[model samples]
Target: MNEPLRTLPSIDRLLGHPQVQGLLAQFSREAVVDLARQVVEDARATASQGQPVPSLDTLAQRVARLAEHRWRAGPRRVINATGVVLHTNLGRAPLSADALHAMQEVALGYSDLEMDVEEGERGSRQEHVRYLLCALTGAEDALVVNNNASAVLLGLAALARGKEVIVSRGEAVEIGGGFRIPDVLRQSGATLVEVGTTNRTYLSDYENALTPNTSAILRVHRSNFRLLGFTHEPPLGDLVALGHSKGVPVLHDLGSGCLLDTAAFGLAHEPMPQESIRAGADLVFFSGDKLLGAPQAGIVVGKRSLVRMLARHPLARAVRIDKVSLAGLSATLLHYLKGEAVAKIPIWQMLSRPLEGLHQTAHKWQEAIGPRAQVRKGESTIGGGSLPGETLPTWLVALSAEGVPGGAKELARRLRSHTPPVIARIQEEQVVLDPRTVLPDEEQALLAAVRWALGA
Candidate 1:
């Protein structure tokens, strides 16, 4: 054996060290013992490779770190400095205070999640948010599932399975995470009948595609991307009219589920579920988290009979929303019903933040981050498969890597390594943090993380 290998401390000896002992208290003894063994094995390998064996204290620290990496609960809270409001990777849509409180209230104790307190009988979980959805979207009834994808699958499986569903060639899109319309239709046992050109699909194209086997006319909103110039698609009302003439139901998939007008925020108008319902869509599907500013869920609001069909389907039970998320979603819808969405919802608040106020915040961040950071004009996007080409003007705190070690990438990485990791973006070889997306309460933490990353 190498001299260093002989000097390497045994797993039992390492476990007795102060750091490893602390780990044992936090984690099970078996887990700690396993980590200790791995640490000793690593030490032995290092020694065999002609490296000096780490001291007992160092080995104990390694065990502690290994345990932390293996056992720590994750999807940790992070500060969004990336300027993307609906960031999919970071869990899109931070809920409002009321929504958070509602989730906590339900999670802390038991509630009548699926019970009729007034009637003293069995009830349904969907009843919790059904009325709120109908009142908000002007629909006769509504249903919710785990996500928009599930809602689409359920709708297709229940209404159009073993039948042809007509979709525009241009609207056959792939949403985030590789979930495509064609794939979903296939999974639901529905045949996809594509009509019209990719950039131009007229009412006639849809009519031409209609047949005796056509179960539904599916109109998917191009929420994530846009075909600039020379793009022409039939209106929702036109599609609805055509479907009615053919005695087929029109299903509108409005992917962002925007309740408010985006034009008010200086962006292109996104299709809303209410507008689709008012236009005579039989089933309008959308997401709860994106523009609705709630928990992750799929919302379907339309005719009562159609919604009931989806609810009664076998897949509905498999994809129903949970109690906690249902509670949070109910609270979020209340914000919309009360007409306080802009004031209460986090995403709306971020969207409505004034340009001047953003500039001031960027300057404040620059002040805290020292002279290396500079306030510059930049654009913040509404990401997460909503408003693909839309961007909102904002200011950014830009930090150049001229004097920093390892340049911009390294500086950004160091910021991400901080506690409550700060997510930023790099543009033109400089790390930029947009104040638009960062919550007001996270300002201090953002400043501290920037300072640490810059080694100020």
Candidate 2:
């Protein structure tokens, strides 16, 4: 046992090996040395336990494989094939090319991020996209924060702290990760006053809840889920009227930000920020990453005085978005302004893509992959908690192979292990990929990944 341990290769010897020299070209010397040490230690431990020691050549191969795994494990791009667009687990929304370019440009060098070039003085970073948001949403002013949750916290803290905020019990919904509206209101230091019953909330309920302690009327959209039977809630116009009757402001938290009328694309209409503004919401807030097809941001747009009040709050500084997010958001808003969102934003493109084209692409994938795959009609959904239970007509390429080693489950796992990992759905004992979610150029990569997954 001692003799085999002594025969184990030294760190210096392994570093100078020809196989390791190749790894040195791709990785730093320090990283290679660290991996070599780990492999050699494993071999020595085996030898000390009176087991057969791996040969130097075998250990060298292990070192190389381990190094490659480490190099490739950090944030590689993944192809979404789960039929869930805006998949929250898969980074929610993919940014447009313009947004990516803008982020890159700002990351490489400094810009007028916080500098007013004309006045030659310091300025607010929020101004970068403030005007654009105001213009697009038709709001008096606009502000942005890290996310929708944070925006709610900031808004409540800024305007309603130490006062009661009246909300409809039906609208106080709990979404993913145990986040509840009542919990957020508690953290904001505001007293929550529930107005109506869970399934039915009438305008009179809101009207009766108003008091001298009431600071604002909080109306939260039930974005993640909905109740169909015997559900009633007051309209925004009516809520605004009641708030004004009591001299209180109305705050609307429109979870997913949608600018385009989704009806034109044959999808259900999602509430837009502009609609909330036009409906007399004193302050309107929504998310940038959802229907907007931009980066993660919490956008607050509405009455100039309310927005300014939120901006001046100390909590605003804590939840403000970074420069990169601002840059990406500004560029994404420009797409809406230029009337090219349907062509440039990936989410809109996928939503509006014709089923006929998707079928054609699925057929081509089926042909390229040979008999191991078959094209079939399937349903795709707009995920990320938007448009729940609604699906779009789409096509899928399903894997059909006999005697698969680990069956569909194993094959699905292996596909995710492929380079740039191909994510797919399992339906009726077959792995399926929707062409609508897969980009045109990524079809080749998807095919190769599928082949590798099937062991063909």
Which structure among the candidates has the greatest TM-score? Answer: 1
**Residue lDDT tens for model 1, 301-323:** 99999999999999999999999
TM-score of each: 0.95, 0.89
Clashing pairs in 2: none
Residue pairs that clash (backbone atoms under 3 angstroms), model 1: none
Off by over 4 Å in 1: 1-9, 40-56
What are the per-model numbers of colliding residue pairs? 0, 0
lDDT for 45 in candidate 1 is 85
lDDT of 2 by residue, 185-259 (tens): 999999999989999999999888888999999998888886789889988999999898789999998888699
lDDT of each: 0.92, 0.89
Q: At residue 30, what lDDT does model 1 achieve?
A: 87
Candidate 2 global lDDT: 0.89
Give candidate 1's whole-model lDDT: 0.92
